[model samples]
Target: MISEKERNVFEGMAIPQILLSYNNGKIKIELVSDSFCNMTEIDRDSIQNNVAELVHPDDLASLSVCFLKFVEEHSNLDVMFRVLDKKRNCYILIHGTGLWQLMEDGTEMILFYFDDTRRIQNSIRHIYSCLKEKDPKAEYNDAVTGLPNLKYMRRFADEKLNSFGACITQQVLIYIGVKSMRSYNDRYGYDKGDALMLLIAKTIKEEFPSSFCGRAVEDHFVIMDEFYGYENVINKINSINQKIKKNAYGITEGIRAGAYVVNPEIKAMNAFDHVRQALKDIGKDMNVICRFYSDERDGELLTERHIIESFEEAMEKKMIRVFYHPIICTKTLKIYAIEALARWIDPLRGMISPGEFIPVLSRYHLLYKLDLYMVEQVCREFEVRKKSGLPLIPVTVNISAQDFDYVDVPEKLRKILEKYGIDSDNIIVEITEQDIAKGTDSFKKQLCSIRENGYRLWIDDFGSGYSSLNVLGQYDIDRIKFDMAFLRHIDDNNGKNRRIMKAIVNMCRELEIHTLAEGVETESQLEFLQEIECELAQGFYFSYPKPIEETKKC
Candidate 1:
């Protein structure tokens, strides 16, 4: 019942206006935020009208739900739309918020007015840019699935739950990731791999619209959903599995969904982090994928935080000590070498495992400092050995994959060696098998540079994670240290694993590469490895890893 004077008043009010009548589904708008008023040569009124026509098909449902929730919770009637024109000439964002009034007859009428639109287009541009930049080798993202990364997921959850008004720490979460993305990427090119990722993303968004889905790794995706949660999403996932089984790719490609639920007070890495460890609890039973993280386990999370902080402090205070563990020649039964093990004896907590803290250091790019400290420590120790006229046993120190990529690593090693007057053969640099696999060319070049200077290079954890068949050709190295697990598994009569160890050793033998085994804890294991003619070995069976005093006592 807007009179001509009322219409004119609305138009003259100097605001972009829309009057929606509860009576007859009527919508009338006054052109205020138009090209004439824009002062920027933009047709604002047409842009506002076109938003209703060009709402995102993907976002419309969620936007509608958001509006329903918004209206039900509060009377603030503002909304923004990023939409395209009728001809799809250009896109515009319409910021429309509403005002509500209760009439004398107790009828509620809502009126919407346009808000600021300048920043809307910028936000859209940034989002699309992020989606467009494709990185295939990115260890952080599931390259085959466009999902949130572990870093992204953890930070996202931590930030959200850290907020005061947010949900509690016990909300249920589920991590859904693709199984064996590498094989798929290998069988097909990256383009098809990316298509699979898009498929997973779409499937997840279509199935659980409210849940947060993010990629955690090259093959893992994390999902956070409500509880009633497992039942809410599990059935649909099963059907998706069945469909994938029957599809053109057939059963070759499998989608795995793991669920973890937390209490309302639980924080999510955008809801994915809370579920990851929970699902991991039931290790191999892939079918019963849903599990909830217990609240009692806050200790683990707190401990991780403590380790990061304490390790940083310990490094600064030089509380981290390098103790040499002797590596004896099996044939000679004499100490010709040793490994420099980084040990942190915290003031209050005592010894800290390098295993626990090393990953965090790598994650935070703190390995550089640790590497430098190791170099310094080894050099000082080498000087003492020389002055004391002790046997110049070559001391091996680890160099992480990241450090190998550093052009300065070899030079850094050389400086330390020269400064301490340590013989080139007295320092052996050990690079991991994974390091060579990840950075083959750079690693090979770096190792070769160091080796050419009369320094020995050894591949640490040889029969371990991501150990490649072409390791010798992949990187220049003189020796491969067997993983300690090999000894235990072999002793347990672990057939395939034991054979893999033999094959690795045999290959090294043919290449004239020396072989060493770590963690030889038992007599049988040592005798068994020695029977294979292993040249060098280290472990508690021969001699326990000890500090200098402990070594003398032995």
Candidate 2:
């Protein structure tokens, strides 16, 4: 009944094809094209009785069910599954379509098989790529959370605002952030971390159905929607906190949310920036759950960005100048030394405060450049002062904790000193107590080496952080500059701060360590510090931080 022409036409097809016949409740391959044999690497004789073995074990049950359904309905069968070849180990992802046919001999057969699985996957990938080009949000979705990623969130915010036909009142962007998720992941496994993230994503999506929710990188989720008023949102956040806390999976630290009410004139990207800025302010305080963006928040990211981008150029142009504040001997009222401070005067932006730009540099790991630049400036300024017939006073330069972490601080400083032909004794290396407390054995050794090289090592901001007194015993520190905060209310002899200050001064005295009081602004503060027998002090009371050029003239 089958014509040679029909058989030849089937064989001429490019795609893999096969015909199956049902006999004794088992499906057997009756007709296979040469293309199918070549693609699967199996000959007609080898596959005749072992057709069932060619199907992947995971896919066999589903394929059998599909065949049964197709037979009963006499409908077309379209299924996507994996099939093994002659190698048995290698599987081909496949898309097969079967059509049931009744031969003239009254026997039933099914015809199916097509191109390999990899081709279909590649085609699908191409389609997704095209979609991503047209709509970027389609491209950068988080696989774990099923939410738009940081990249997509930024573009989506701007586009959504542009498309809004009317102004919506009190629209806000909220950033929900989880703290120490990395530590959590380390304690548990990545699977648990993924599950927790999924749970968090699900909770957020369910809670704020009206909002546009997105994952702004790891452990940071963003929601843009109408503000629920401060009280309502706070209550909602508390509710979320309780839920997450109850199901915390042994995680002690909870989540915090920060909000920024949208300023319609401002770009959506900037508005979300306000949200991130607010989130950073919330920080690690467990008592604080949410914070709103304020205009008073230290610095703007625009200014921060400008500082980072222009830092190298600023240094090259000598726009970043080193100024010194005199630290006088309390007993003699003499200018014993000066602390080198960095001052940035941007040509375009005028004067950018260290308070504004220092943290920016630190966050981006660029603070080391600024610190080293200050060292170079200090060395250069010392020579300039000496050449100008002004006294070359010993200068103390603050080295950031980050510098010691990455670079050889002592080695680098020694090289710079050698380059400038200056004695290490004329330059003091000032590191924070926090730095010394957290430093490793290697860092401690670096501090000792700096000291051995004739550089005086002073612990700056000694009483400010949660540093232990044990640091004084651990490292080779020459002096301890007590934080200004310790002297804030030293005027009150009965106050706890004054008592603690007295105790610290006494403790340092016992260790034969010299103590310098910082921020001695008022007459009363200075008198009290002197009464406590503090060795040296620096403040606006004596003189403000002045450039070497200005000091030379003075």
In TM-score terms, which candidate is top? Answer: 2
Clash total of candidate 2:
1
Candidate 1 TM-score versus the reference? 0.54
Candidate 2, residues 1-554, lDDT tens digits: the string is 45687678766677799877777766776677888877777787776767778777766887788789987787998775666765656776666788977777887788887766566557867886787788755667876787888877666678875543145566777899887786665444355677878878777766788878889878989887777688777777777767776776667376899887776677886777788888888766768898989776635756877888899999999999998999888888888898999999987889899998998898899888899999999998877888888767789999987887789988899899889899998998899887778888877777788889898989998878666988888877789998888777664557888778778889889998889989888888888788889889999999999987788433
lDDT of each: 0.66, 0.80
> Scored by Cα lDDT, where does model 1 land?
0.66
RMSD after CA superposition, every candidate: 17.6, 14.0
lDDT per residue (tens digit) for residues 168-220 in model 1: 43344556666667656433334456677677677667776876777666656
Error of 2 at 237 (Å): 3.4
> Which 10 consecutive positions of candidate 1 have the poorest summed lDDT?
31-40
TM-score, per-candidate, Cα-based: 0.54, 0.64
In candidate 2, residue 54 scores what lDDT?
Answer: 76
